[model samples]
Target: MPTLLTRQRWQLLTCLALLLALAAGIGLRAPTPPDEPRFVLAARAMVETGQWLLPHRGSELYAEKPPVFMWIQAATYQVIGNWNLAFLLPSLLAGLATLWLSWDLARRLWNRRIAWWAMLALASCLQFGLMAKRAQIDMVLVALTTLSLWALLRHLLERPNTRLLWVAGFAAGLGTVTKGVGFLPLLVLLPWALWRWKVQLRPGAALPRARSLLWLIPAFLLGTAVWLGPLGIALLNDPSPELQGYARELLFKQTGTRYANAWHHVQPAWYYLQVIATLWLPGSLLLPALLPGWWRRLRRGDSRYWLLLGWALLVLLFFTASPGKREVYIFPMLPALCVAAAPLLPGLLRRPGPRWLLLAYVLVLGAAALGIGAQLLGDGAWAHAQLARRGMPETLLPVLGAWLLGFGIVVLLLAAWLRQRRAGMLAVLTAVLLWNLHGWGLMPALGPYSSSSALMQQVGERIGPSAELGALAWREQNLLQADRPVTDFGFKRPWDEQWHDAGPWLAQAPHNRWLLVLEQAISPCVDRAQAVMIGSANRNRWWLVPGTAWNAACHAELSKDAAAGVDDGD
Candidate 1:
């Protein structure tokens, strides 16, 4: 068995393991909020309307992000004809690509063993696995950035390969289109230039010429033009105020202004330090042993360390300087960090201290899962309250509890069987188990509530076939999950404006029209006596308001209330 598990077989096995872990729940759930539903909604709109250029959330344009990621989702849906799988396919593929890039880059730089370690270390990270499993654009961006960095490193450290440099530049551009941070990989040039200036090169090793580096300009522009060219043409031909505004918002406000003066998600400068320590776990666990080795290599003037570690530091500082901070903002650096740390892991894992720490970490995770499962099964107050707060059905509590308990027992048993010598294997296996449980078990269990599919279905059933449905202050999940066509007032428009418009629309066909309203956005004009209360989903209650529920007498009062509630901010 050991002989059969050669370097190639091990790499192939590792890739398969990652695929199972990441793709476990592809078709089991609908997109849930914070970001998922909005993107999926926009992609669905693109597919339905056949207007692929600009993304829309209900009737309004979604300019908060570029259209590249949504385009991928839309394209995938066109091919596969499955919304669930298509929505998440890009992230899965991107994740696999990212792992391959990390592995291959490490192998080229050092050896296959180091490459395997790099891939495993990265796949075992909490953040990496979390992002890979979601339909978010960050994983795609991470993949692109990793590709760019991998190519650039090869060109800079190994030989003056212009083709690799062009590949790096193009990938960085596509990444920027995915998320504004895509160009981050190009920051490697700064470190590379600094290294060349400061250190002496070997007899045959030489840096690429300045002229060859200039090829990046056209390659980057070509990539950027993939999205920008069409957008610019659309803006010019349409000349609509809305389209023009979208262009400005996406190009400037969402990128430069948001970064320079972030109005939301504002965190202190040291916020990323906390995120790295906690969210980047298991991989981060090796930091104490790896840091000194990294410093020693830096002192010895290793160009590989200079390119990877230096670019990582530049990325850290770039994000740190911004007022706004998110944990995922620094995710693009994880691959490079993993590759840099890979060569040291074998030696570190052989030591007793790191092995003991890995064992303890896994044991603690198993114990926590067991304890929480026990609490839930026992019908503890905290467990019940949590289920109630999330609007999860009480009946599923036992099922969820049993699943967690079983997972904990299996994890503990596996750890005991593997012991400390195979602590790395234990960590990888535990991660796989956790993700599988989350995807196959927990996600599907939570899908009905978390994605608002249950609530939307109820809304559809209550209204019947002949009734028209409209929404005020509706979330993306509400709109996306609706069984029939739903008329939304506007996603970003003020609730008062939506209410004012919705009232008249409901009045137009009094008996046939119904308005689904968010609990907080429901105006005083809505008579609760006539309105039906739909159950909560995504932590917000919903109301199915009939035309008869509208009290026109309260219009003047509602205007005053709306005026009072107005706040000027994004």
Candidate 2:
């Protein structure tokens, strides 16, 4: 291993390079759908109104998520006076912070080589790398959760300090405010605490005093109250039944209803198994080979390995059991996965053998890259058509060729470097470099298709600043991109009965109003004209302009589509 990569010398430079790559071009493009636009627009609304407690997309209350992440984004926007970097800066900073904390944790638990390798495993991952660069809640939540766990685990390993425990609790509470899964570290702590209490209650077993919980408990409550208190007061002062309903929904329904009986993105228990195997790709491939080593360590009466495994399983199984699932939901456990996997690399690359593990990894990746590159070169339009089917932009087959070629070169270098044990780490470094290049170079090409900004701008030019804009079956990005007051004509959530009463209000709105909509419905829609197909991203096509009328044809067509479950696809 290079001593230069260790904290004693070149480590800071390496970290800076990594951070630069992660933060670079974060502001270069507008956000994409589903999560980013919604959160960013809500933050924009928050900044506009200075109402930090209740979030809004436009005039409607946005109850999908709590406001900790939004608050950071809004503050960033306030300071920068623009939404460009502000929307994604939180995730970037959080991800870099995660990398640093992960390095320190690995250094404490193991050696310098293991620490560097652990951080590389995380930073190089397909899942973690992408999430860190995007404007998403998962990265922030993962960062806070990891920090809380790190503090608590430090106390668990050696120093039995009440202050560390308190910090751990406070961080965990903030994590909760960040996302619903924020307090999961406390689950790991609870078992450890009970085990400690059990052992401490007996005769002295190399330790006599039980850990203090006095400050830890109170700190956690206060951290939660940082947001909850304001939420309650905001609801109390408003006296609106809708706000009260939002309060109840945020507290209870978003937890139980969204988890046990999720309204969207439901998946089977085994979904994460596939996601972890792929998205954590090439890194997680060693899990099968690494398990026996962990088992042996446990058999030798070393509890650390099992503790890490338990923490990982706690995250994995919890999300696995939930009816709602996303690939990013498994991210909070990536730290443990990286740390636990770090030690196996040294043995897996041992020189006494033919280095089968390294060879397999290189060959698999190299071949995969070659296959993609070949396919793109031979059938460029075929790939383009495939992306078109998914409502994605052109694959930029030429750029993909370059990306794959570069990846292949790195894989070849990885194969060559396997002659030396220290060079084994190059595989991970190359992966990270390839991902950074892809993000900085190729991914931005899709921005036109991914963002609604251009369409919004075009419409803004036509309608000017005074006109009211609305969207039916539209995304939040349209609202964020619009300069005028925008209305969400789509039903945000099934519980949002506000849409049920939308007909009269929508019909009564100003005559100069224009609504943007998806192209699939305009055939049956009312008075549709000059409806330009603007762009496509993630299986949806957005249009520049679509007209609406308070006629039976429009209502009948909408009602029929609603009955036919168009909302399910939209």
Candidate 3:
């Protein structure tokens, strides 16, 4: 086996390179739809409008989540003025924290070699690496959850550090604001309860100190108060129905309505079980092969395995049991999974069959990349037709070409590692670095239709950046794309053949000149002769309406609000 110092410099260099790549393109891609725009817009609102306590999406109260993640993003954006950097820093840092937590946990459970191997294995995890750079809640949540576990596990191993027990709960509490699932750390108590009920710890069993659980509550509540206190003061001082409703939506509805009766991303109970294969990647392949080894460890009375496995399994079961499932929901458990699985890697890789198998697995992965490139950049009419059927853009050809080259190089690198079997772990880390490049570099082209950032910049230039804009409906991407504040003209219904209906909603404005941006497809059917055809981006068609007649009745209400000294709610 390679000692702790074997190829240490190369390992450090590769890990550092991967970190740079992971943190490379925070602001590169347009903020994606469904979740990102809302989060991005909320952070932008906080920075621009100074509503740090309350997060607003466009002109409406956004309480889908608490403001911890948004607060960090907003703080970053405020200093640097780069939206991508602001939006993505939390995930990147959280990913780093999770990796360190994994390394420490491995070192505690086994040794330094296992700890180093664990960190590398974790960095290469397909899901963990992706979330690390995304403008999403999962990565932060995972980090906090992992940190909490690591702290508590440290306390268990070294009873002198009782302070870590409280730290665990506090991280969980902060996690709660990051996402509803922030309370995952509190779940650690379940296993302790189980152990207490069934098994008696020997004198030096390194179990949890009994009194430590008491300190966790205050720390958790204190973490929550960071957001809750400010939010309360803001809402209490200036009460509004939207703000009130948002509070309920976040605290309860997001948990209850979204949990029991989720409106979006409702997947099967077995959904996570199916996605686990993709999430763990090469490590996942070794999982099945390592089962006997894991079972042996468990049987040998090493209670640490039980603790780690129990924590990960409980998280998996908790999310899987929920009706609302996303692939990302299971990500928090991955760090623990890596640590738990780290011990088996040294044994498996020392064998010839496992090394050859890993090589073959990577070979298949490379061939898959080549095939994707062929379909994307090649003159395969059948592939073009297939992609066209799925509504992909022809512009993706070049993007795919770049990804193909990157993957091809990674394949060659993996082959070299295969030839030099001692560098097996290097191959995996390098593969992850390549994967990061593909995801971060080529993401813009992957989903062309969703984000309108590039197109919206052009619109902003033509209409003047300060001009306030509004969307006809609730496609929230406009808020992120627009340079100015975008009022949501909550649509009565989507624009259709009778598209004139959207005119009133689209035309309503606090600003005099109304720049109604619509899909190019809708413009042809919507009679644009009366409006000035100002500009168009790839697929977004823009028109300027002179009269502020969008939603005329809303205009009457606005007049009343002005007379009553009531500023409009956004």
In order, the Cα lDDT scores of the candidates are 0.88, 0.71, 0.69
Q: Please say which candidate is ahead in lDDT: 1 or 2.
A: 1
Give the alpha carbon lDDT tens digit for every residue of 46-165 in model 3: 877777887776656666678788888888887888776677777788888888889988998889889988888888777877788677888888888998888877776556375786
TM-score-superior candidate, 1 or 2: 1
Output the TM-score of candidate 2.
Answer: 0.86
lDDT of 1 by residue, 495-570 (tens): 7887778888988888999999877777888888999988888777889999988876676435564534422222
Over the stretch 1-570, how does candidate 2's per-residue lDDT look in tens digits?
A: 565446555666767767777876676778887688888888988888878888876666777688889999999998988787788888988998898888888888787878887897788777888888889999999888888888877776655767778788888888787787788877775546545544333233232144465566887887788788888787667888988888887777787788888889899889998998888866766677777888786555444565577788888888988898989888889987787777776776575332455456666777788677777667666777866765553446767776776777667676776644543565566566665665665557556556766566776886667767666656677777777777764545431233333334445653566666665544333444545665565577766443345343343434444433334321
- Could you tell me every candidate's TM-score relative to the true structure? 0.97, 0.86, 0.84
**Top model by TM-score, which number?**
1
Error of 1 at 139 (Å): 0.5
lDDT-wise, the better of 2 and 3 is 2
* Residue 244 in model 1: lDDT: 92
lDDT of 3: 0.69
Per-model root-mean-square deviation over C-alphas: 1.8, 4.0, 5.9
For model 3, the superposed segments whose C-alpha errors exceed 4 Å read: 1-7, 200-203, 206-208, 234-239, 382-396, 416-423, 444-450, 458-468, 491-512, 515-570
Over 4 Å off, model 2: 1-7, 190-208, 351-355, 370-379, 390-395, 413-423, 457-468, 493-511, 521-525, 528-537, 543-559, 563-570
Give the Cα error of residue 29 in candidate 3, in Å: 3.5
Error of 1 at 466 (Å): 2.0
